[model samples]
Target: MPDAVVIGAGPNGLVAANLLAYAGWSVEVLEAQPEPGGAVRSDRGVHPEYVSDLFSSFYPLAAVSPVLARFDLAAEGLRWSHAPSVVAHPLRDGRCALLERRVQETVSGLEAFASGDGAAWLNMYGMWSRVGSDLVQALFTPFPPVRPALRLAAKFRAAGGLRLARTLALPVRRLGDEEFRGDGGRLLLAGNALHADVAPEAAGSGAFGWLMSMVGQSHGFPVPVGGAGALTAALVSRLERSGGVLRCGERVASVAVRGGRAVGVRTAGGESVIARRAVLADTSAPVLYRELVDEEHLPGRLLRDLERFQWDFATFKVDWALTGPVPWTAAQAAGAGTVHVADGVDGLTRFASQIAMGQVPDEPFALFGQMTTADPSRSPAGTESAWSYTHVPQHITSDAGPDRITGRWDAAEQEAMADRIEAQVERFAPGFRTRILARRILAPTTLQAMDENLHNGAINNGTTALHQQAIFRPVPGTGRPETPVKGLYLASAAAHPGGGVHGAPGANAARAALGHCGLRTLLHRAQRI
Candidate 1:
C-alpha cells in the first residue's frame, strides 16, 4: 500500500505528492489525461513551429507564490521570460496604460492619464512593497494563517491596519474611481480583477486586482522559457526525484472508503490502489462529493451545502498562428505580454453585469496574450503565437432568445462568437484578422471536455466571490484541505486561495495529510515495540 494516492496530476496534485514523498511517504499520482499540467499545458502541433499555451500563460502569482518559491524551480530546468511591460490597456484614442516593472516607470505611465494619478498609483505600490510579501504568504497559506496575518497587522499598525483592511475590501470599481482620475489606471485595475469571476463592482474584487497588479509590477508577467509546460515539467521532475510515481491516462472511477476512512481509489479500468496513509484528490468538490463518495456516506447538511456550491463564469478561448506580431494602434501594447481589449473600465463593468444577467454583451471584453513577446522561441522569427479568451454566463439560454446567439456553443455558434471576439481585437489592433494564418477555438464545452477541473467551463474551479472564498470555499465550515472523510482531502483550485497557478492548495493538503500520517507511524512503531 502506498502512503498516499493522489488523484489527478494537476499542479496541486503533483505538489501534494511531492511533499508526501519528500516526507518519506511512498506516493503515487494518477492522471486521467495522457499528459499532466492540467490547465498549464502547452502545444506546438496546432501550428507548425508555433508554441501555444493551451489554457494558462502568464504566471504573476506563480512567481510570488510561497509554495512555489520553496521549490526553487529555476534549478529544475525551468526558465522564465518576461516582456518589457507586464500588461497594457489600450484606449480608443490609441493611448495605452502600461504596468512596468520599475515603480517610477509605472508611475510615469499612470501620470500621463491624469494629474495626481501617479501619486495614487504610488500609494498602492508603496503599500504592496512594504507588506506584499506578508500578504502573499497570508493569502496562499492554509486557512487561519496566524503568523502571516500578524505580520501584516504589525506592518500596518492598529489604525492604519483598519484603514488598509477597508481598502482591501473595496470593490475594484470603487477603488479605481477613488484612486484614479483617468481611464488608464482605472481600466488597469478593473481588467486585472476580471481575471477571476469577480466583477469590478463586487466586494473582494479590489484585493484580487491589487494583488495581481502589484505582482506584475514587482515581477513582470513571467512565462516559462519554452512554454507553460516547462513549469509543469519542473514540478514533475522534482516529484520524481523525491521518489514519487506518476501514472497517466488513468481515470479514477471512485474513491474507495472503508469504515468511514478513505482507503484508496478504484479506476475506470477496475484497478484499486490501496493508500495506506491518505487519499488526496485534485478534482472539483462536486465531483468528489456527488460522484466519488456515495450519498449515504455524507452528512445531510454537507449534502445540502454541496448542492448550493456556485461556479465561476464559463470561458471561450481562441488561439491563433499569426503571420506577424499584432499590429496594435498603441505601440506600447506591442511590448506587453498581456493586453486588455475593451472600451474602458466602464465597458468592463458592463460586460460583467451582462454576464451576471446571462446576457452575452454585444461587445465582449477579451484578454489577449502575446506568447512570443515573452518567449521569442514560441514561434518562428517573423511569426507570432497568440491567444485570447472571454468569459460568458455559465447558464446560457438553451434556445435562441432575443438578441442572443443561442448560448449553445456548437461549432457554428462558436465560430460566430469567435468572430465577435476577433472583431473586438480588431477594434484595438486593426487588420488583426488579416494576420491570422490559422486559428482554433475552444468553447466552454470544449474546455470542460479537455479538463474535468474546468467543469461547466468555470476555469477558476469555483466562484472567487467573498461569499464563496476564504473559509467558505469548496463549502462553508470546511476549507482547510481536509474533508469530513477521515483520510480524504481536496487539493484543487476549489480550495482556499481560490485559483491561479499557485500550488498552495496542494502544499496545504500535503501538510494536513502528513500530520496524521506521521502520528499514525509513531503509533504503529510503538505497537510493534
Candidate 2:
C-alpha cells in the first residue's frame, strides 16, 4: 500500500506526488494515458519533421510557479528559449504592436500607436513589479483567507492597502482606455485577457491583463528547447528523483470510499491500489464529483454546484508542417512567439460576443504560435513547425448532437477550417498557404477525446468568469483541495488559482492532504506500520 495514491499524471498530479515523496511518504501516481504531462505533451509523428504541442504551448505561468521554481527544471535538462519579440498583435494595415522582454523596448514599440501610452505602460509595469510576485502567489495559491494578499498588505501602510484594493477592483478595459489613446495600445491590454476565457470588460480582467503583460516583460514567453514535452520530461525526471513512482497506462475506474472517506481507487484493469493515507485526484472537478464519487455520497448543495458548473469556450487547434517559415507581411511578426491575428479591439470584442451567443465568429480572432521561431529544434532547419488555435462556443447545439461539441468535422470541413485559419494568417503573412506541407486539425470534440480532463475542450478547465473563480471555483465549499469526502482532494485546473501550466493546484492539494495525513515523520511511521 502506498502512503498516497495520486490519480492522473498531469502537471498538478506530478507536483502533488513530488511533494509527498519529498515529505518522506511513499507516493504512487496512476495515469490513464501511456505517458504523463497531461496537456503538456508534444507529438512528432503528427507531421514528419515537425513537432506539435497537443494542448498547452507557452510557459509564462510555469516560469513563476512556486512549485516549479523550487524544482529548478533548467538543471533537469529543460532548456528555455524565447523569441526575439515575446508577442505581436498585427493590425489590418500592416502596423503591429510588439511586446519585448525589455520594458522600455515594449513601451517604445507601443509608442508607434500612441504618444504617452508608452509612459502609461511603463507606469503600470512599475506598479506591478512591486507586488507582482505577491499577486501571482495570491492568485495562483489558494483563496478565501488569501494569505499572500494579507501578508502583502501588512507590509504596507493603511494607504497602500486601500490602493491595492482599489487597483484590484479597477476595470481593465477602463484602465487600458484611460492609459492609451490609440486602439493599438488598448488591444494589447485586451489581448492578454483573451489568453484565458476572461472577457476584457470583466472586472478582474484588468488585473489579469496587467499581470500577464508584466510577466512578459519580466520573462519573455519562453518555450522549451526541443518541444513542450521537454518540460514534462524534466518534471517527470525530478519527480522520479524525489522517490515518486509513476504508473502509466492505468485508468482509474472509480474511487473507493470507506466510511465517508476515500481509501483508494480501482483500476480498469481490475487492480486495486489502496492508499494508506490519502487519495489525490488530479482531474477536473466534475469528473471527480460526478463520475468518480457517487452522487448520493455528496452534499446536496455541493452536488448542485457541480451540476451548475460552467465550462469555458472550446477551441479548434490547427497544426501545420510548414515547408518554410511563414511569409509575414510585417517582418517583425515572424520573430514573435505569439501572434494575435485579430483586426483590432472592436474585432476581438465582436468575436467574444459571437462566442457568448454560441455562434462561431465568421472572422475568428486566432492566436498563432510560431513554434519553429520559438524553438528551432522542433523541425528541420529552414522549415517551420507552426500551430494556431481559436476559441469557439463550448456547446454548439445542432440537430446532430452539438456540432462543435461532437467534433463531427468531416475531412472537407476540417480542411475548410484549416483553410480559413491559413487565410487569416495570410492576411498578415502573404504566401502562408504555400508553406503548408501537411496539416492536422483538432476540433473541440477531438480534444475531448484526447484528454478527458479538457471536458468540452475548455483549456482552462472551467470558465475563468467571475462566478467560477477563486473560492467559487468548482464549488463554494472549502476553497482548499479537500473534497466533500474526507481524504479526497482535487488537484487540477478545476481547483483554485485555476488552469495554466502552473502546478499550484497539485502543490495546494498536497499541502491540504499533508495536513490531514500528519507531519513528515508521522506519515513515514504510519506507512511503515
For all candidates in order, the CA lDDT equals 0.88, 0.81
lDDT for each residue of candidate 2 in 1-529, tens digit (9 for 90 to 100): 9989999998899888888887778889999988898999899866867899988888999888777887778889999988788888887577888888788888898887888878878877777777777777777666654578786676434337676666655666776777788766677778887888876677888777777778888887888988888988998998799788999999999999999999899999999999998999998888898788888778889987777889888888898899888877777788889988887877778878778777766677899999888988889999988899988777554211122432356676566666777777888888888888888888777887778898767898888877887878877765678888999999998899788888888988887788786685644432221
TM-score, cand. 1: 0.96
- Which residue pairs in model 1 clash with each other? none
TM-scores of the models, in the order given: 0.96, 0.94
| Best by the lDDT measure | 1
- Scanning candidate 2 in windows of ten residues, the lowest lDDT window is 398-407
Instruction: Give me the displacement of residue 255 in model 2, in angstroms.
Output: 0.4
- TM-score of candidate 2 relative to the true fold: 0.94
Measured on C-alpha atoms, candidate 1 has an lDDT of 0.88
Q: Which candidate leads in TM-score? A: 1
Model 1 stretches with alpha carbons more than 4 Å out: 398-404, 519-529
